[model samples]
Target: MILSPYLILLIPVLYLIGWIYWFLKHKRPSLNMPRIISFHKISNTPELGGTFNTVKQFESFIRFLKMNGYKTARIDKILAEPEEKEILIFFDDAYENIYNEAFPIMKECGLTGVLCPVAGYIGKKNLWDRGLKRFRHMNENQLKEMSEAGFEIISHSMSHSDMRRLNKESLIKETTESKRTLENLLNKKIDYFIYPFGLYNENVKNAVKNAGYRAAFASYNEKNDKIDSFAIGRNTMYIIDSKFDLKIILERKPLFLFGHEDQKGRIINWFSRFSAVIKI
Candidate 1:
């Protein structure tokens, strides 16, 4: 595919504007406060969908974080110590691949991750999603072992439905019952919530807060005016991301330094919106 002359000429203009925007934004005290990265699967599965990271990529990224003096911590710790090199690692969907692959790697680095599993899908394959490469969600035993090993297991949702489209009664159950389900299974308090598909509104946030979750996380799609713990946003990690892409993502990097791959990430993230339309 070749770019048209008009589109080609317009690219630099867009970057110039984006650069100005980036400069003004970062010139302040700093806008890269909540540095959280969310991952789906941690396997070398073959698929057109670039969701899972290979074991090698996962290990390299973790090694890069350690080399840069970063430590994985809970969201609460990250918030309390704002200036520290603390990051929150999230393994959304709680796939068995994550337990089999990412768990040991993180342990080797003396870091832990927060696991957000769909309460109803535990011990079952991800039939709710629209994909050819279906994967299994961690069973109760796998989840329990990780929780005992110091990984935090929290609610992704009861059935992993879109919260923005649910009714009041269904909304309440998704937030409240899911937490109850996980707490009973893990025998520990489930404090935080990660919105399925990263979709939520005021009602969703209120429901989560009322459900006894001290904080909740949204994906990159939802932009917040400030860091609202109930609606905090997290960066998503894709298969194509490299160490340099991760650097630009960790900080609100300069415009001139932002590369084409980073721009591709922004475009790819648009696919997340498809979740509202389909099970994917």
Candidate 2:
């Protein structure tokens, strides 16, 4: 069937309206400021509740951020120069596929990222997510290579367990042991801690600080206002997120375009808090 001239003419008008709506909803006047965001997996793994982004998609996404005048910087740099407009890319869960897929693309783009690996599961499969299909974590050598190549290697706890549920001794071990293991393996000072499952509380944050971490990150979908380093918020990225989704995050827009915590996320968080209260 052939379209009428009037209908064809209306197509562009409709496109313009949609574009304007997107701009009004997502544009950030303070876009030229520092921000922290995160990604996980960076692969198309078919697992329940798993977050990922294919290699090609990430490359284009990175390009889009740079094109929009966003500079990719490490966490330290962003902290040191808060006035500069930069984006800190944090990757949670050290998956081996990241070394094969995302790492190369990041190197090609002259960009670097922060990888938060579970110390106890290094070179092993993720056993925490029992129901979902498991995948291999990055090995010691891969972690070292990444560190040497200018990537920031950080900790995501000892075994990806909920920090809030951990007793004082267990929480201390998770924070201290993981930091020690990573520092020893990389022979570098590991200063940042990433809250596993994005679940944390005053006790968990205190444990991280008492463990000697300079800062910590959480999966809160907003920017950290230099309030408390231990509970710094981050925007999470997934395989489903497109370049537009990422742009909304990097821009620090008014809306939560991506990585909003869902029911499962809330359940894990609630369980963690409740278990901690009962001292379980």
Best by TM-score: 1
List model 2 lDDT by residue over 1-280, tens digit each.
Answer: 9999999999878756755554454342344334776766666655445366677777788777666776677778776676445778887888898888888877877788889999999999866553245678999999999999999998899977777888999999999999999999999998999998778889999999999998888876233323456776666666566676676666545433322322223344455335333421
Clashing residue pairs in candidate 1 (N, C-alpha, C atoms within 3 angstroms): none
RMSD of each: 3.1, 8.0
State the TM-score for model 2.
0.77
Worst lDDT 10-window in candidate 1: 22-31
Per-residue lDDT tens digits for candidate 1, residues 1-280, read 9989999999889977865664455332235457788788888875345667899999999999989998887667776666557888899899999988998888899988889999999989886555557799999999999999888887898998878899999989998889989999999999989888777889998899888898888774233235667777666778888888888767645535543433455566556445324633
| Over 4 Å off, model 2 | 1-34, 130-132, 221-226, 254-280
* Best candidate according to lDDT: 1
With a 3 Å backbone cut-off (N, CA, C), the pairs that clash in candidate 2 are 52-239
Q: Please report the TM-score between candidate 1 and the true structure.
A: 0.87
